[model samples]
Target chain A: MDIVCDKRAGGTLLQVNGRMDAVYAPAFEKECLLVIDGGEIKVVVDLTGLEYISSAGLRSILVSAKKAKVKGCSIQFCGVSGMVEEVFKISGLFTLFSIVPTVEEAFAA
Target chain B: MMKPQGIAFRLASLTLLVSTIILAIIVGYNYSVSRKIIVALAEDRGTLLAKSTAKKISTAFMTVQKVIDSVAFSLEDDRLTEKRVNELGQRVLINNPEIFGSAIAFEPFSFQHDNQYYAPYHYRLDGGPIVFARLGSDDYQYFYMDWYQLPRELERPIWTEPYFDKGGGYELMTTYTVPFYRNRDGQKVLQGVVTADISISWVQKLISSLSSREAEYVFLLSRYGTFIAHPNANLVMNETVFTAAESLEYPQLREVGRRMVAGETGVVELNDLPMTGDSFLYFSPLPDQHWSVGFVCSKKEMLAEVSRLNREVATLGGLGFVALALLITFLAKRITHPLRELTVSANDMASGNLEARLPEATTKDEVGELTHSFQAMRESIKNYIENLTETTAAKERIESELRIAHDIQMGILPKLFPAFPEHREFDIYASIEPAKEVGGDLYDFFFVDENNFCFLVGDVSGKGVPAAFFMAVTKTLLKVVAESRLEPGEILAKVNDDLAEDNKSCMFVTLFLAIIDIRTGVVRYASAGHNPPLLLPKNKDAEWIPPLNELVAGIMEGTQYTTKSMTMHPGDTLFIYTDGVTEAMDKMNNLYSEDQLMVVTNQCLGKSAEQLVDSVDKSLKKFTGGAEQSDDITMLAMQYLGKGSKQEGDDRWI
Candidate 1:
């Protein structure tokens, strides 16, 4: 899994790529945790390059979500569709946060 | 040599010490024996010379006295009185040729002389005519000399120590003086003494001729301790033994001189002499004159032959010692070389070179035995490693092939979600996780026809290649029957018959297969010894449908399955799974039973088919907490949306 974190206008743009299964979930968590630890409250995860994800990856995102909320920070996801979108919809995490179609729109939300 | 702790050095040193001690003993013995022999010979020669010289002096004195006695007896009645005394003395000198000089001295006034001293002394110059001198003068006090006074005091003829008679104008001489009487009264009266002068040259000549060796010198010392005749001309008649001992600083010479003067006969060893090396002095006293004859011999010259013998013995012993040392070194090396080779071989083995070879031992010693054992051990190690490597390779090959089979089996399952994307009537998703590299669980879905869709979840009877092969054949048969226009129940029943007809291995698959017509909003489902799916109604909680109680597929030839009909509402969902889901376990061996599945599904209300499956999967992983998955888990979920119904907002990207 490749978690590319970039600085944006309103937050850190974290681009998640590749299969975020149980083997790669910890790396996804660590990338988000580093941004939060650096005092960057607002985060945007770009799923444009993401090819696949599993339940273990979902758990990590859920934990990151709760942490961001408690810290008065917000996390938005952009560029999601197909199997990854269905995974979020089935796990009921689609209603938990703002999901946008593009990086610009995610940070705007 | 390896550590300076070998026996060769010890042997060499031992030989050195033993040979040194033996050589010292032999040399010391030789020295003492040679010294004793030389000293004994010297003492014997000195004693013989001393005795003969004393006898010669005595005989000379006796002959002169006898001649004087005969002359005195002839003159007793005035037969040629003092007129013939001179002629008689001349005759005595000519008769005794060994004497360098002969003299007859007379007492004064009674020998027909008018002077108070009428003594006449006659001595021959070397091989010359006899010279005469008158001793009647006061300066010629021959009447008071030891030659005159000592014999007169004892009333016997005595030989005097040799002395230079300068006043008498004679040679260095020893005088034998005897008294002659004249009848001046009736009682025996004192008359003129008769003296014979014997030159000391003859005795000195005797000493010189005694020995021919240069280091062996003979000398005589007077009773008064003066040197009389010595090889050293400066000491002859000039130095006494006491004075020479002090000047030479050879303290032992004092003892020698004392012994000589005391008429002692012995040999003394003198060490550290000035001009000569160590020497031995042998002395014997001439009692007639109380003089001593001594022979001096150098110790070096005396022991020269013994030293030569010592040198020869040392050379021979040294050669022998060298030979012994070489032999010992060679033998020691011969014994220890094999041990060194063994050490090297052992080191090579420790470094993992089992093929290292030791040289063959021919001696049948313990080293040879060790070599045989080591060879056997090496062979054993080689065989052991070869067997281990072969066994491990076989196991790895089997495991790798199983992994490839697992990949193929997992590939054949339908993994793409929303299986019918153009058909908005339903969304379906499924997944299969095997317990091992290859599993017995399988799930697949496809279009039976244009309007009818088919899907199924199943588990075979066992795990691994056999069950996986069986699962594949069963799955393919079902697809063929579904395409042949058979109902879901008939399709499974036909697949079962086809499978049971030729199946030699007793294998089975528990299947829950379904076909639905999206246009009619109806789902036709069948169960063959499989778990029923949960119907999650649009308005209420989900529930398990009653089982059809049919025989499982691939168990019997004519196993018939029953169908159940259910019309799905626009939002109703169907969740079907194998027993692996219900029987999933945690580390403590706690099972995720049917009750737990329902409890987990309660959180899936309003979720899509994919989300519902993922949520259950998440729950299984969570429940198990990373424990080993011991069974295959297979699940298929489908949500039906009735015709003409659509998502609130939707966009499909090309």
Candidate 2:
């Protein structure tokens, strides 16, 4: 898995790609906490290039969201589709965090 | 055994070789230069001796000639008598001891008118009394002798060649003869001859005394090259220099003899002379006698001191070379001692003794640095091995514990087959297989009442020990809620609320819970974000129950669940499973997807619940083709027989 972080007008953009399973899930969580800890009040995680996500991946995202909430940092997810969208709906992560269809929509929200 | 040719040996040998060559050059040069100097000095000494001896002989001859000239002047009177001539000759001999004899003879009948033989000689015999003899008889014809005849013809005073005078002196001698003349009527007439003879014994003594060394000898050669005085007494007057050169077959000696006879004075090397191996000859002519004196010096005797000096120098140089070689070897060994010790220590280390003692680094050099590095390397390797051993032990302990946890989790599931055999109304079988030592997947079945049998299959989010614990908690809460005889939806709602309370980790389980009434063939089930179960009727294709879009349990609090009812005919089976079946992957990462799961389940339509679960598992294994199972797999199947269906031995169903 790979994560590319970029500074945008709306927030810090974290573009996540590759399989987010048990092995690589910790990397995504660490990336999210790194942006939040760096005083980023708004962060957007783009999963447009994500191929697969396991339950462990959902757990890491939930853990990162909770840490971001405590720091008063908002983390938004964009490009939730395919197997990742199905997992998000079943795990009730859709009701817990803000999600959008694209990176621009995530930034606007 | 031969020792190793190490640096010390090589260094010492090189030093010895170089110094030996330099010593040889120095000694050889010294020997050659000194030999040259000695030869030159010997030549000068020989020339000086020859010249001085010749000068002394000339002075002695001049004194004897003066005495003889005085006797002849006295005999030149016109009124002289024979008795007066005898007295005059005797007087001259007595006055000069160097003159051995004196003679006065009248020219045949010139001294008297009738006297044909008239000569008188006076000589001393071996420094004895002077004896007078008349030498005018037939036995001793003094007028015909060279001394008398040569003066009459030449009319001048002259010295004869050295000879053994048998008739007069009877000894080896040479004579100086002078002719006297008388004036008669203003014309000069030859009166007689007057002569003085000198023995050559004194000349031999003088030549012998000129030599300063034992190997040096002096010789006197006459005008005809005869040996007048020589080191060998027999060769004197018997052998000339030319005869000795011929007998020895020495051309160079013959050339020296020729030069001396020609009155030339010089020094030459007498290499061809017999007995005298190498020598130098210096020859010079006497000023008065036309004779040459030669001084011979042996070259070996002259340079004996130089040879001794060279021997001593070579001995001392050899001793010094040995000492230098020893010192070099000692110093070289001292320098390499540390390296030898290092080799031993390195060998010990290579043989697996990490704690081998290293040589102390006394000097701050490369060897010292190498020793320090080796020590550091040993310590690092030791620490690395210690850390690896400790980590392996800890990991083994955790793995053993995980195995135990897996056993406990498996014990909680309903594994026994033929459940509720006395009722004969339904058959249930469930199995849970964890992907790891302990997993989050679980299945349970139990009688909630006499008529109501409740069963559930759940998948906790994430895996391993944490999920396993969450699954256990969900199963316990689910059992408690289901025993209250509430609907399946109510039991799910109550269990979800309990699990969601203070759930800080956001952990949840996807569950499909159901309650079946055995007599009525009525089933009421609810799913909390779980995969819908498949309904398989006997001799009919399998179909999936419609799923509710409800969130998985244990995520949000107070989430309501709705129960859906399905009536099962006799010989109908209901199958439930976690996503481990559908999401299983092959080596190519292709999923054993839901479509494949449906196809395999449809094929196993008439199989018992236990057989159905086994067939699905086999199909999954076949589809994955040895790829690692990424999650826990839990499967539960139930078949309802209905109220009227009774067991007829082994042929009740199927």
* TM-scores for every predicted model: 0.51, 0.59
- Please tell me which predicted candidate would have the highest DockQ against the true structure: 2
Q: Model 2: which docking level applies?
A: medium
State the lDDT of candidate 2 residue by residue for B162-237, as single tens digits.
Answer: 9788876898988888898888889989888888888888667656665567337888899899999987888899
Model 2 misplaced regions, further than 4 Å: A34-42, A67-75, A92-97, B1-393, B418-429, B518-521, B532-546, B567-574, B585-590, B595-629, B637-654
Candidate 2 TM-score over all chains jointly: 0.59
Q: Report DockQ per prediction, comma-separated.
A: 0.01, 0.53
lDDT of 2 at B281: 85
Candidate 2: tens digits of C-alpha lDDT, residues A1-109? 8999998877899999989988899899888888899989999999988988887888788778878888999989999999888777765567677998899888877
The Cα error of candidate 2 at residue B116, in Å, is: 27
Superposed Cα deviation of residue B202, candidate 1 (Å)? 2.4
**Alpha carbon deviation, residue B433, candidate 2 (Å):** 3.4
Q: Residue A53, candidate 2: how far off, in angstroms?
A: 0.7
Candidate 1 residue-wise lDDT, B368-486, digit = tens: 88878877888898999999999999999998898888888888887776677888878888888888888878888888788788888887765667778988988888788888978
Interface RMSD of 1: 14.7
lDDT of each candidate versus the true structure: 0.75, 0.84
